[model samples]
Target: MNIFAAIADPVRRSLLEQLAREGPTRVVDLTRGRGISRPAVSRHLRVLGDAGLVRAIDHGRERHFELVTDALAEVSNWTATLTAKSASAPQPPVAGHHLDALGLEVRRTVRERGTQPGTRHTAASSTATGEIA
Candidate 1:
């Protein structure tokens, strides 16, 4: 199952949140303060581990469960890309000067595209006056 489907259950989400806050913990530790039984908690942990959301590591006789941060980082980067695309779409200018500023910014960005391969460009850096469009 996908990460979203695996975490759709409230119990599973709680387990993840707990692991995020409390660090790696044993099954007994996870279910101690929770309202569910140990077996139910184990089942949820199994699903999370399978989905790569939570990782289990052997600690002595018990297994400690912890959040898999890399999975969350991938999700965050995907969301950020979608948010930036929607936010940057063209819209009607609020004033006459706004359209001119937007045009200049776009032109400057195009001009800077052939510079060094590793060079970084911000919205302000692309503008002649160092102001964001």
Candidate 2:
């Protein structure tokens, strides 16, 4: 099972959280007060074990399960790379910002050329005035 798929279930995630919080724990302790049967929790734990997200150790007659955080490095790296790319990505222009910038540029160009509103230098006027150059 894929690590992501193993942790996708709410029950499995809860079990991992419990293991991480309480360190190594027994199956009976894990099922206590959770309203889930020991067999069901064991099945979930088996999935987690297959995904390398958790490990089980036997001490005498009891089995202890503990979280294996190293298994999540792939997920962590993937998310971190996505976050970095998004942080460096160019943001989309805000509404009306492009128009506002265009308006300012037009105003600046008109001011520089000393052109008046509703008046423009046409090809005919430039040719007649010999100002084509």
Candidate 3:
């Protein structure tokens, strides 16, 4: 299961939060007071385990599962990368009255010159109220 997809389920996310807050715990400890069934909790844990979101340790007859934060860190790192890239990206020219006026001038120039068919460039003319032709 995808890590993000696994975390999408509230129960699985709650399990992760519980593991984070309470530290490593056994299956019984995880499900003892919860309304969810033991088998359901086990299934959730399996999905988390597949996603590397949790790690399990077997001690005697009990299986203890703990949050493996490294997987979450990977997600964090991916978001950070996207954030950094966006921050460094160039901003587009802001559209305002100035741009609207410039667009009018361009349209008028195109109307005066007219457009040539089969040319690489084609221009559309619009009125001040923005009716297009």
Number of the top-ranking candidate, with TM-score as the measure:
2
Model 3 off-target regions past 4 Å? 85-133
- For each candidate, what is the lDDT? 0.85, 0.92, 0.86
Clashing pairs in 3: none
Pick the winner on TM-score between candidates 2 and 3: 2
Candidate 3 residues 16-129, lDDT tens each?
999999999998889987898999999999999999999999889888999999899878988999999999998768858888998888777767756443333423444533
Candidate 1 per-residue lDDT, tens place, 24-81, comes to: 9999999997888999999999999888999899978889999998877766887899
Could you tell me the TM-score of candidate 3?
A: 0.61
**Lowest lDDT block of 10, candidate 2:** 112-121
lDDT of 2 at 114: 69
RMSD of each: 16.8, 6.3, 8.9
Name the better of 2 and 3 by lDDT. Answer: 2
- Candidate 2, residue 58: lDDT: 95
Model 3 clashing-pair count:
0
Please estimate how well model 2 matches the true structure, expressed as its whole-model Cα lDDT: 0.92
